[model samples]
Target: MASNAFRKELYVFERGPEGKPVMAVIRNYTERDFDGLIRIQQESFPPPFPSELWWTKEQLANHVHLFPEGALCVEIDGEPAASITGLVVDFDPSHAEHTWEEITDAGYIRNHKPDGNTLYIVDVSVRPMYRKLGLGKWLMQSMYEVVVQLKLERLLGGGRLPGYHEHADTMTAVQYAEAVLAGELRDPVMSFLLRCGRTPVKLVAGYLEDEDSLNYAMLMEWKNPFIR
Candidate 1:
């Protein structure tokens, strides 16, 4: 992959006097961007979320070494604002059940497949201050562009239901997912993904270790419309 597989100047957006739109650069991350990504993970997932679960230099380096095209980052005013990491997988939709650790190789993404038909999004990190600025959808779009460029069949990943823990007692994980789908509930990650055009395929348990999602997440996918 080229060093600059994809790069775009996107205007950061917000409303109601919170801020003005800032010119931001969205492009693939290199080795030097690892520490900034770590800071992003720190701000993105705060306390109670294990800091050890965050990206390490080795893992980030592995990402670039294995599949440089998949390691992308967003910069606003030359600071790392957000990033999305993905790896190709020759996926079998019939055998989609797998833990995050199993598929992602614990975020090291050692299982990356260059000839794979599906791009499995491993992680997305954004500094807390960059949240709610429509960055997630752009990141999703960036990956979707990747899928299209590679002629991949689809973009797939686990979408966390961070809001479910608050309603766990009232509903099963599946039911909580259904509620979110039906517009009866709002989940930070799930809702954001939905707005970004991903559809929930099913709910899976032990998808990842997250206090908010209770280790449950929705198996989501977005098909490439340009393909067919």
Candidate 2:
């Protein structure tokens, strides 16, 4: 069992296979969750994404050690189903061009800053089996709540443009993103993010190694208006 120090939570989700409502538990991940986290990462990002990009034991450990509050996990039926990892950083929107490694300290979150005003999301993945359960949205909401509770300015992430590759030949990454926002195009990542209340700030390149995204991503952010 994990410690109570972490923010343990229960979120009711859509009905399960039996047509009965199910409950998912959200909480901070610990050292023991490394294997499960690794499994999910592989399941989420397969061969083309580069196996080396997967989470390392050291990275997972550093996440919990440096900032337990930012390390989140989801459990359904006592099994790890999804996870989201992030760190706090002092973000400058005007000068926001950066690769994932620079922002997240190579996934170890060694760059986490407690006094920073932004919650920088580094990774979010859900098991294929539970994708239909709406766990992704719930996980994001959990992080948004963290931003509100910490009195942060906003929550942000370099969201991959997974559907960009399809339109890459005819349009630029920025144009593709704008089209998605305009409802003229539907991108898996961009559409899901928009539905989650995140607004795209700009299109960034070299954000990560997602071939489907053509190594480009849109910087998305959700401001915490209640933070004064």
Candidate 3:
């Protein structure tokens, strides 16, 4: 849960389809927000992914302890509707493609490097009811703010293709990613990342056990525009 002293909010107003302004409150995660975060994760990601993949209280605590400023949540009607979590890491091309466990060290976040050049995104989730409101992009924009504040060179993460299971028998993960990039196919997550100017760096096998992604994930990166 977040400490009352550290709780702060940023109001974001977006034009709805009818030209009405939709208001959302973006704020940092608090210790009290853990259950809501976990609930959102469960609702956002369905079966074939065990509960272990969800952010445990311990993991959340570790993240907050290591970098409290790296986690942010978007609240709607006083409930957490979306959230983003990340950690700073030194970039290493030689070890660019790492599994989720390898990158997060089993969700302990012991690898966070304050002086690192990369902001490695560990997780980003939005409630199912809030999908079409452009909240995901808002969460991402907030992440860019974190990158700038930390003076990082880039943002990196393994993007899951929740729709990949449907194409597993027909195409490889790499092929699917290329097709999505070429505008031939649409993916809930990958397409959004591409639209945000993130580039796919590589295909990582066994990134997670999610059957939807066929156990494969795309290594994606977005370079910091503010940094040369």
Residue 188 displacement in candidate 3 (angstroms): 1.5
For model 2, residues 1-228, the per-residue Cα lDDT tens digits are 324344566755555665456677898988888899999999998877688888989889998888888888998887789999889999998998999889999888888999999999988999998887788888898899889888999999988888899998999988898899899999998899899999988788888877889999899999998975
Worst 10 residues of 2 by lDDT: 1-10
TM-score of 1: 0.94
Provide the TM-score for each candidate, comma-separated. Answer: 0.94, 0.92, 0.88
Query: Model 1: which residue pairs collide?
Result: none
lDDT of 3 at 56: 93
Over 1-228, each residue of candidate 1 has an lDDT whose tens digit, in order, gives 574488889787774677788798989898878889999999887887788988899999998889887888888888789999999988887888899888989888888888888999999988878886777778889999889988999999999888989998888998988888899989988998998999987788888877789999898999999876
Candidate 3 clashing pairs, residues 3+ apart or interchain: 1-30, 1-31, 1-32, 2-30, 2-31
lDDT of 3 by residue, 128-185 (tens): 8877677788878778777876678999988889888888889988888888889999
Count of clashing residue pairs in every prediction: 0, 0, 5
Cα RMSD, each candidate: 1.6, 2.3, 2.9
Off by over 4 Å in 1: 1-4, 17-19
